[model samples]
Target: MARMIPDNEAKEILVLYYSQHGATRQMAQLIARGVEQAGLTARLRTVPPVSATCEATAPAIPDSGAPYATHADLEECIGIAVGSPTRFGNMTAAMKYFWDGTSPLWMKHALAGKPAALFTSTGTLHGGQEATLLTMMVPLLHHGMVLVGLPYSEPELTSTQSGGTPYGASHHAGVAGELPISEHERKLCIALGKRLALTARRLNA
Candidate 1:
């Protein structure tokens, strides 16, 4: 039997997300933990809240928790795992708005060939968790990223009653975002992160 050799030059993986009610943030942290478990560093980042008014702007820095993501962060990461709460069966406007600003990086092909994964939290079991994950991958695909998804081989996908999908990890947060992440959902999240990191490391090598 051959022993596996780990990549020695793996770049940091970025776990970026936007959460209106904090559920998605918790999922991001769990994914980050999974990435670290795979022996890769995780750089967590969040986007600023969007405003309905045309002239409104967020402060230069967030009040607490992860800092706002920048183009530089995207450029430097080797792998990326993005998460957002489902909004009308798609990613939130804040996350969409953030990706809209990445044209420069796209043009430069800064993210080409990198490994990327998606995750989401929804208000209900049928609240389009899979659609949100698929939709979130569009921009990343346009940027030429390699999409990483959870496989059916993961037992949680077959057994989970709440939220776990082949598209990516998901959580059912209920209408008020009051539901706790189920045991299966958490395991799936960690699995997604670990798989993503391992894939990125191999590809980078």
Candidate 2:
């Protein structure tokens, strides 16, 4: 049976991502903070690592931190914020694999009309952060979610030297995660989350 999210309960926002070196994870948390700031519940979830040689199974539950995202998480959330580190100007294979498995939900229109946003981190200044963010949106678009992006009106979009784009929020992690997220990048992430949550609430109403 398909799980149902109760109308009476507070709207839930799912912050899902696959972080290789923790920078993406930090971005997810920052986004979650913004979701909470908008008075919505944020459920943080992560995807398991994928194997290249053969099909591998992760334990039913993760060893620590957020549980691996189940299809139910996508169905239960009124909004979604997805993040990943750039892999040759695209989302990592692990993250892409997770989305590829969501065809069932896509067919069911489970996420239709929900508010969604994307984020990404890159190793260098020109390391395809925007392309990565844009590519990540493809699957979400197929699922019928509304794409929310940072608008040029956000002052940081104009002032940001490290990472900020109209496509979505982003961070330049530098080589080996040496660089911290800039003030502009952090604020933009929070803003994206808040915008998604607020949009979800308004849509639900």
Candidate 3:
């Protein structure tokens, strides 16, 4: 497959996610902003939703939003930040489906030693935000990725009533999924990206 990104640059960080109602998408954009602020390029990519029909397939190009993520994206980026709306305290099936096909990369250790971070959005304040974040780390660990997470020094971790955690950045959307991302949650998302980018840069250097 052709490269989605230019070959010269090795400073790009991949922001990969699957969003159902836009909350996670917003968070992904904010994270990208942070990554840019830290002097790295952010390659925003999304996975196509998994369909129930065995033969159903997505178009080569997405109708809107970021283009679908390719394994090449995972291999090309120096770092990655993964996001998803929580599903029963775990990543959405679509997100899981994307990672499930990455065994080829795992075999090659393509992502080993790369920095990775996680972010998640939930339908309720008590929904599985932290659990989703923790579970998301499993695949990255399998690939030998160095996990990056929010530190207590961010302040938002202690102050945020909505959603912020040491596990990773998180947002507590209301039951209707209408609540805006809280200020603390937004800041933490950006911080996570910045921290991940900085870590990746240092490791790459």
- Residue-level lDDT of model 1, residues 65-161, one tens digit each, is 9999998888777889999999888988788889998998888888888889999999988999988888888999999999999998899999999
The residue-by-residue lDDT of candidate 3 on 5-87, one tens digit each, is: 34466679999999889999999999999999999999999988877653226787989999999999999898999999999
RMSD values for the candidates in order, in angstroms, are 4.2, 2.3, 3.3
Candidate 2, TM-score vs. the true structure?
0.94
lDDT for 74 in candidate 3 is 93
Which parts of model 2 are misplaced by more than 4 Å?
Answer: 1-7, 54-58
Q: How far in Å is the alpha carbon of 196 misplaced in model 2?
A: 0.6
Q: Against the true structure, what is each candidate's TM-score?
A: 0.93, 0.94, 0.93
lDDT of 1 at 85: 92
Pairs with backbone N, CA or C atoms under 3 Å apart (clashes), candidate 1: none
For model 3, the superposed segments whose C-alpha errors exceed 4 Å read 1-8, 53-57
Error of 3 at 156 (Å): 0.8
Once superposed on the true structure, which residue ranges of model 1 sit more than 4 Å away at CA?
1-10, 53-57
Leading candidate by lDDT: 3
